[model samples]
Target chain A: MSVEAMLQTIKLLLPALMPSWRFFSVIAPSPRIEITLLKTAKDTPDSWQEFRPRPAHLSIGSMLKRMFYNARWNEALFLTSLAERLSSNPTEHSSQEILKRIKAELVRNSFDSFDSAATPHLQFRLVFVHREGEQLQKHVTFISPVYGSFGDTDS
Target chain B: MSLDYAIRLTEILLALAFIQQSIEHFRAPRDEQRLFIPRFILSILLLFGFQTQWVCLALVILALFILRRFQGPYNGGSDRMGLLVLCCLSLINFMPSSLWREYVFGYLAIQLVLSYFFSGWVKIKNPEWRNGQALRDVFQFSAYPVSEALRTWMNWPRLLVVMSWSVILFELLFPLSLMTPTTLIIGLVIASTFHLANACLFGFNRFFWIWMAAYPSILWLQQRIFIVEQL
Candidate 1:
């Protein structure tokens, strides 16, 4: 086989073989995920809460432990990538993937308002945040229509 | 470092890395979680030095599932480094000749060094990184900051500038450190500390272990070059 054909075959079989190593050079807007509970279109949605609040406080010992046991944080990074893609290109497959994942996450956790609405619904949005001086600034880049509070069942 | 010693260190470190990563994935929702099982098992096998050659080959095959699971590296550089180490170990273990194994180790060491150098080169070139704005933005805006408390570091503009320059210079001059054993050890220490600090501040714990897994390759390669010169 030609080298080009061989290379093409390898690429198909081993997708992870290609990698770009450039890291942490540029500072771009960071994506933050937020979700709100809503009862009706007319009902003002409850104030937005950060979807994955930085674990309240990772103590020094815990932080040290995380150096070896940090799959949770790695997942956070994965989610951030999904959020970034969703914010930048809402029509892409990753955006849909993130949306499904978010719905699944919300279903697995308790809603903020335990005072359940007759028919509770959740809507999530991607916010792109940047720091200017000491103040953190943010703007909502994308919002999903109200999703049913069930896995992959979001409208 | 002896090749035997380096290989042993790498196997253990990479094993710990895989186990930790699998533990994390184990927490994911049911559908997405089971994918790491084989990786977890192989990592255990690799750690114990059980059927190492066969285990390396299995892990190499399993890496495909990992990439497929995340569509790419779930965490880019760490996963990339992990895969590189995987491929290197697999090739070195299977290849019978010492010379070919040395070449594989060389490729890994060169890549490891260049990861730092190119990162520093790009940062130095960027106006934001040069002025410390990039570091400021990282502490201030990036999701990387492990805690809201870290943003307080943003108050010291001059300190940020000094730190930024320090990183740029260290990474840029890293290649020169390979000249002698003393410099190489110092360079590796500083580099590992840098990764450690990043792990603490950014919760990028995986990067710390995966990168460390590759360092023995650098030490091994350094010794090889000096021996070649002596010959």
Candidate 2:
């Protein structure tokens, strides 16, 4: 099928897949999410400058493709790692501490396997989005800036 | 090439691809592999290309509905493309004598071709893709990174531009290559090389084989439509 047609199909099905959208508003109405990592461009010398998913220029159909690909691994990895870290203290309020811990865990677990030469560091951030409803407020929280990079392993 | 040989060749490639993917899946953490193992096994069986029609059909359905669902979020393009190829294979197998089988295979070929075009079309329109930045970004620190040398390519914007255009042109013109047997062979070779590069550079090994498996269908359609029209 054409990409346009495929997207139309997805648009028709999105409502069914996410039935609770009507109950609350999205934090970012725009599909694109811009995130600034913890490190500056100078600190990272990776061949690939950015690690975020840039769907800003994509059509809805292409964006859907990115979403599918990201959800398959990237998003899942972040959420799983976060959940694991959060398991120890469910009431923790320090997003910064949690982010730091997540970054450390990723370094310990993922960096060596992905040993790329260009990226100097891994960075992450926390994003809290609130949905206001008639009777209650729903807050959805996730890591905003999570990226993987392969740096030159001198070894 | 003859349609018979073309189809057989595709079957071989498909079998190899799925078996490789299954092995990779098996190597992953148990939690990830558990649900996909059975489907991968069945796909490998179907790849043998000698299975009974009913058996192949059953395997395809099971892989699509049951095994694929179990794979959960991990499943994406590879699974979707694999399913497409398997469905086409099943349809072709179940109705070997039907005149409409050619159309079924044609549809598969068209979808594969469009997949390429759509990907390129999307990229060409995006400034990041056009400037070669997207390529750099993907190679740098994404899920599949091969080496540090890939980063140096960013320094040469001209090279990146040329490479980006090459890809876009290749994808857009891929369908035209199906106009003749010779062109179709050439097209398949080029397409195979592209997939091979993706596999070696990005670990998209599954895409390599699954896309290769679709080649025979394209060849079949070309021979069916263009050759007959020439006659």
Q: What is the TM-score of chain A in candidate 2?
A: 0.25
**Candidate achieving the largest TM-score:** 1
Tens digits of per-residue lDDT for model 1, A42-135:
4556588887677545689988988767766777788898888676655555666666666656556554553334546667788899866657
Count the clashes in each prediction.
Answer: 0, 9
Fnat per candidate, as a fraction, reads 0.60, 0.00
Which candidate number maximizes lDDT?
1
- What value of lDDT does candidate 2 attain over all alpha carbons? 0.53
The pairs that clash in candidate 2 are: A46-A118, A116-A150, A116-A151, A116-A152, A117-A150, A117-A151, A117-A152, A118-A151, A149-B141
Give candidate 2's error at residue B8 in angstroms.
Answer: 3.5
Give the worst 10-residue stretch by lDDT in candidate 2 chain A: A23-32
Locate the minimum summed-lDDT window of 10 residues in model 1 chain A. Answer: A12-21
Residue B180 lDDT, candidate 1, scale 0-100: 97
TM-score of candidate 1 chain B vs. the reference: 0.95
lDDT of each: 0.80, 0.53
